[model samples]
Structures are given as C-alpha cells and as structure tokens.
Target chain A: MALKVYADRMSQPSRAVLIFCKVNGIDFEEILVDISKNQQFSPEYKAINPMHQVPAIVDGRFKLFESHAILIYICCAFPGVASHWYPSDLIKRAKIHSVLDWHHLNLRRGSAGIVANILMANIDGHRSYPQVVNQAEGILLKSLSKLENFWLKDGRFLVGGSQPSIADISLVCEIMELELLSEKDHDRILSPFKKVVQWIEDTKIATSPHFDEVHGILFKAQKRFRERMKTQSNLKAKL
Target chain B: MALKVYADRMSQPSRAVLIFCKVNGIDFEEILVDISKNQQFSPEYKAINPMHQVPAIVDGRFKLFESHAILIYICCAFPGVASHWYPSDLIKRAKIHSVLDWHHLNLRRGSAGIVANILMANIDGHRSYPQVVNQAEGILLKSLSKLENFWLKDGRFLVGGSQPSIADISLVCEIMELELLSEKDHDRILSPFKKVVQWIEDTKIATSPHFDEVHGILFKAQKRFRERMKTQSNLKAKL
Candidate 1:
C-alpha cells in the first residue's frame, strides 16, 4: 500500500508536504481534511492525528504529523530520494534542523499571524488592530532580514547550500500566503526585502510544477477574495 | 578543544541542552549568557547566534542554535553516546521529530507563556491580568491533557519507547518551569494531571544528577520569590 498523506492545500505546511511528495515522486494517497469545514475535528480524522493539524502521514502502521517531521520522514524513509534535500552530512542536516526549529516562533508565526489577522478583520467587518498588524509585520521583516543577511548570504538556499533543502520549501510556502492580501499591501510588506523576494522566486523555480500545483488552491482563494471585494465596493458606489 | 555551549539556566531550552550534554557525557564548556542582563543582545554574542537565543553551540567552526537542533547534533556528532537518545531507526527518529515539532506551539508555548506572565506581574508590581492567566492556563492544561492521553499513553518515554529520547528531555524541561511558580499555584496548575506528574518524575530519575543540577537555579529563584512574597505580606500587616 502507498503512503497516505492527509492535507489541505489551503494550509502552507500542507502545501509544503504535498509539493514535497509530488516533486520527489513519492507514491502516496492524498487525503484532504478540510479545515474550513472543520473536518479535521471529526472523530475519524482525530484517530490519525489527535492534534488535528494538517500535513500528517501514515506509512504502513506508523503515523506522523507536523509537516517538517513529515518532510524529514519522507526523505529518510525513502531510499531513492536525493541526499541534498536533507543531506546526510551532520553539519548540513544540523543547520537545516536549526532553521526548522527556529521557524515556528519566527517566520511561521509572523507570516501566519499577519495573514490570519488581516483575513479575520475583512470577514468580521472590523478594522484590523494596527498594533497587532504592526507587531506581526515587525517580526516578519526581522525574520526576513535574518534570512537575507545570514541564511542566504553565502548560497542560493537556506543553510548556505547549493540546492534548496526542505527548509527553503517550508519557509517559502509560508511567505507565499501574503499573496492573499491586496496587491499594494502584499508589495508593501515584501518590497523592503530584496533577497527574500529573489529567494522565493528561486525556491519556486527549483520546485517547479509541483509547487504551482500544490499552491493552486491558494491562488483560487485569492481570486475569490478579490472578486468579493470588488462587488462590495461596486455596491457601495451604487448606493 | 571542548565544544562550547552558550546558555542560561533560567531559560528552559538552555537548561535542556545543558542537562543533555552533561548527562550524555559529552565534553563541553558552558558559557553563561545571562538573558536577564540582556547579554544576548550584545554584538559579540549576536555574532555567535544571530537569533540571539540561548542553547547555541560552537562545534569547532560550525556554530548552531536552537536547543532541539543542538541536542540532535550532539547525539550525531559525538561517538560513544547511546543511540536510543536519537535512534537511527527511521520510524523511531521520525516519531521523535513529530513530538519535537508539535512541542513548539503547544507544550513549550503554553508553559513558557504562563510562567513569564506570572513572573512579569511580580517583577513589575502589577497584578497579573486574570483573563490572560486564565487563557494561558487553559492552553497549558489542554496541552497537558493531550500529553497524558495521547503521547504518554503507551510508553514510559515519549514515542512509546522504553528509553528517553531528546524529545523527552526537551519537553520535560519545558514543563519543569512550573517549579518557579508558588507552591500553591504550581500544585493548582499541575495537580490534575496525574500521568504527566509521573512522567516528570520518571524523566528526572532517568536523567538524575544532571537534571537536578541544571534546575538548581530555578529552585533558588523560586525560594527568592517566596521570600519576597512573605516579606511584602508581613509589611502590609504591620501597616
């Protein structure tokens, strides 16, 4: 039986895992557990992952969650995978692990928190708290600065490697969430960090069709959000 | 030359790494970076770890940060260490990774946030906001419940193994921060979770002298906090 992957493309981690599996040509069954519908909370799904977060996987009897773990597992469990994705060299792997561990409260927190606050404000018809938005933006920019000045200064990918590792994939997927914001807002937030913008593009090109395919849902959602905003403004003008 | 570890015992991750190195018999030098003194912000320290977090290591020319990564690196880089700490078995290692990744936003966040708020309130001479404490308590308890019901259900250590992995060390250290709370508050928060209490004891026994030694700073700090509280209450009575 093939490995079973439970994911929802709307989630950045989920997308990272899906793209990873696709790009690596790992045989797997894609099982979507839609968080929008609260499907992850179902008793059946909870059996697989009590945490109810996306990007879990089951390989035979072994079950796992946490997208970074899943990515590491895929690399280690599969024999055919190229070593560069999660290098066997102790220092390289350690550096990648450092990035992944640091990611949660830094890049992941900054990007996810900012996007969630913006989306919540739009949906609830309340102006987002400037302080909260500013705080998140500050953290996001600081993280980006670290990435540019340290992680990517010597090499094209995170960990100063010639090839992109899972760290690049995980982080880039996170930054990509900003596309849901208005074009002006998105550009304003990202424009100051030139290297980060280039790194994102490099990661995209490195991952190619798989990256685009996994992120298709996010693009669709962005379009829907834009159309709704346009319709609401048009109605206001008519009134 | 010995591996140089930068750490502060007051920080949980730093303590975890310190204990791991000592217990595992890894030769190392501990360089104290007193976060309370804002030593982590210094340019010299920043050059060692741009993230400016404790539990960084200099293994020859390679500098690494993040406690989890440091733990993994020690296990891998050093010879004669027990393999069970970071098993080479793919499934076992992957399960350990899952726990470490899940820990960041769950157990680590919940426990650290709660303790920090209480400490800040005491230091700043402001009553802690009850709502904030309550919310943090809720998250901490929820995380503990998951630990008792799921993670610890089948195993003496996390990941259903007889031996403790770095995951167990990382998590148990985070929970150990509750020792800083007043006796009544600590019991009130942790008393309901029977299994977690047992697990903490088990982990302590497994790690032994190193665990106790590293945690000595926290115990002394707790005593100081209690003495201050008693003095303040006595002065109020005299008034």
Candidate 2:
C-alpha cells in the first residue's frame, strides 16, 4: 500500500505537495479531486478531509492535510532529503516556521486576487471589480518587492541563504497557480513581476532531478485546463 | 531584564500573547505599539518588525513575532511548560498546526472584515461605497458561521476534545475583536451568531487561566469606547 494523496493539480497546495514530493523523492499516490467539478464536496472526500479542501494525504493510518504541515511532515519523515528545506536546529526551524506563518498572512492572502478576479472572470462571464483586482495586484506586487527586499534578497530561494525551502515552494505555487489555473489575467497580471518569473524558472531547474513526473503533471494540468475552458459549463454538467 | 513584548492589546494577535503570558504565569514587560496611534510605523518599531505588525517579542538577543509561533516557542523555551499549552506528541502537535493553518485561511481571513468594515469605517467618512461595508458584513457573517460550524463542535476547545490549544486563544481574540472594535453594525450584524456567543463563554471557563486578562481587556476596550462615544468628534477620531 502507498501513501494516498487526495488532490487536484489545479490547487496551489496540491502543486506544492507535488513539487515537494518530486524534489524530495517521496512516493505517494495522487488522487485527483476536481474542484471545478465539485468532487471535493462529496461525502467520501469529506471523511478524509472534513474541510473538503485538497492536498490531503493518508499515510497508512495517519492522515494529514494543510500543505505546509504535510511539507514539514514529509521533510521530517524522510530524512536525508530536503534537510535544508526545513532545518533541524531549533532557531532555523523556527525561522522557517516564522516565514511559513508570515507567508500565509502575506503571500497567500495577496494572491487571492488572482483567483477571485481572473478565475471568476473566465468562469462566470462577469468583468471583475477593478478595485478588488487593483488591490490584489498591488498586494502581490508589494509582496514580490518585499520578497526581493527582505525575504528573498538575492538568496537563491526564500528563507535563509536560498537552496529552496518550503517557503519557495509555497510562494511559487501561488505565482504558478495563475498560470496553472489559467486565470483570465495570467499573462497580464504576472508579467510585471519579472523577479518572480525568473525565480520560478530558476526553481524549475533546481528541482529537475524528478522533472519527468513533476513537470509532466504540471503541464498536463495546463493542457487539461485549456481543453476544459472550451466548455466551462460542461465541468459542472460532468459532475 | 524582563522578556519584552512589543504589542497593542487591541490587536487580537497581541492580545493572544498577553493572555498566554498571563495564563502560563510568565511575567513579561508589555510594550505598547498602538495600532490606532500608527505606532507600528515609527522607525524604531519598523526596525523591530519590518512588516510593522503587532505582537512581537524580544528576550535578550532573540526576537520573535506571530502569536502562534511565539506561543509555541515560549512553550518549548520554558521547560515543563510546553506540554500544558501545546502538546508535544506528533499527532497532537500536528492537530495544532493543522487547526492553526485553517485559522489563518478562514478565521484570520474572515476576521479582516471586522477591521475593514467596523474599525476603518470612518476612514473615508462614509464616502466609500456602501457595497464595501455590505460585502465586508457579508464576509464577516459567512466567516462567523464557518468558525461556528467547522469548529466549536463536538469539542470544548478548538483543536480537540480536551483543553484549549493556542488555536482557541487566537480565535477568542478574533471573536472578541468584533465587539472591541465595535463595527457600527456590531449589534445588528454580530448578534445573530448564537453558537459563537456560547462557544466564547464555554472557552472562557475551559481556558480559565487567562479569562481575567481576556475579559479584562475586552472590558476595558469597550468601556473606553463607550466613554468616548459621548462626543461625536472623539468617536470619529478613535477606533
């Protein structure tokens, strides 16, 4: 029996898990739960993750959700892999936790605009609110600059002196989510953050050891999304 | 030198630290970074926390922030004290992490409505669009129901069927914040959530160690607000 990960590739957290597993060489089965199709709300998914959100894993009898928590567990559970990703020293680990905590309030929250505005625009046929869209844009831009000025600061990755920790994976997924989820403002919204664009490219190369499966699933998600968008109403209808 | 906590009791996360310190019988100097006073922006405070948020701490050369992270650090830093607040077992600790993660996305995100709608209502002198307030109010209600339904069920505390975890303290502060911040629609808007009201009372007893500080601050904030409301200009100036 293998570790069962209930997720859909479209979710940022799910992708974070995929990238982490690929980078760290963790073996787990990926169970797809399509959000656009409302598979997450079904009773079976609810039992594993009461919240009905994605990127949950059931390792033997131990079940875990919440991407960062799983990332910590994966890093801790599998020694020798991604040790620098989540350092062992108390202070370094705490710093990682600090950034992870701060990331939720900052990076994750800032990226909500990309989804609420652009995704909804494409799916619902409504022009998004300009102010909400602008504020979200401002937050992401400010955060990207802050990431550059304070958090990133020429470090190859996010926390400490680079080498891609969980923060990098967490944040990259958020930026990639726009592209991954095919947001209406994908190209326009993400173009200005040149630093982030390069960071993602750099990260792709850094974690290329398991690129075959990792990159394959990512591009597959993009292809599937592009195909799905042709008949948006069919998503709900398929469900 | 005492442990220095730079905080504003009015801020929920800061209040969480204040209560945690009070409950665990840890004495620390409370340095006020007044949110309304815009003290967080002062060059001195900004250096302390670049993001310029509240509830930060300094113990000798080490400094930390983020109430959840700080609470866990204090738990481990103080020998024989970590178990009481944050259980050390992998599962118990994971529950805390999982719940805290949920709080960040849902409860914390939802609580922003209180600040946006209630606290900052006067910033634009009612000149802002009505939809902003209405939308915030709507988010607040939905979030409150979420807090009540997803959590506060089959358990006295936020995490499990036992004593309060750091999650409860963080949550209490958020709920109490709605009242303390006194959104103009506090009565009509917040009065509907009875389950949350009951959960607050239940939590007070279970986590009785800090009940006084929790209620005391809640008491003082409202008292000050009521006294100031006697004058319209003062009411307009404060919040």
Best by DockQ: 1
Task: In angstroms, give how far residue B110 of model 1 lies from its true place.
Answer: 0.6
In the range B1-239, model 2's lDDT, one tens digit per residue, is 77899988768889888888877777689899988899999999977787889989887787777777788777777664647478767766776788777778766665675555544444434444467656765667776776667666657676656677777787877777666554455666566777677777876776676766656766786767644544545765696
In terms of lDDT, the poorest run of 10 residues in model 2 chain B is B118-127
Residue lDDT tens for model 2, A1-239: 77788888767788788878867767778889999899999999887887789989887887788988888777766665757787766666666777788878677777866566855765657886778867877787677777767766646676656577777787777766566445545776666667667778777777776433545665776677666666775766788
User: Which tens-of-lDDT digit does each residue in B68-177 have in candidate 1?
Assistant: 99999999999967998999999889989999999999888789888888877765577887777788888899999999999999888888768889999999999999
Off by over 4 Å in 2: A78-81, A122-124, A180-198, A209-239, B119-130, B133-139, B146-149, B181-199, B206-210, B214-217, B224-239
What tens digits encode model 1's per-residue C-alpha lDDT throughout A21-132? 8889999999999998999999999999999889799999989999999999999998877888999999999999999998999998889888888877765467778788
Fnat per candidate, as a fraction, reads 0.98, 0.35
Against the native chain B, each candidate's TM-score is 0.95, 0.81
In model 1, residue pairs whose N, Cα or C atoms come closer than 3 Å (at least 3 residues apart or on different chains), thus clashing, are none
Best by TM-score: 1
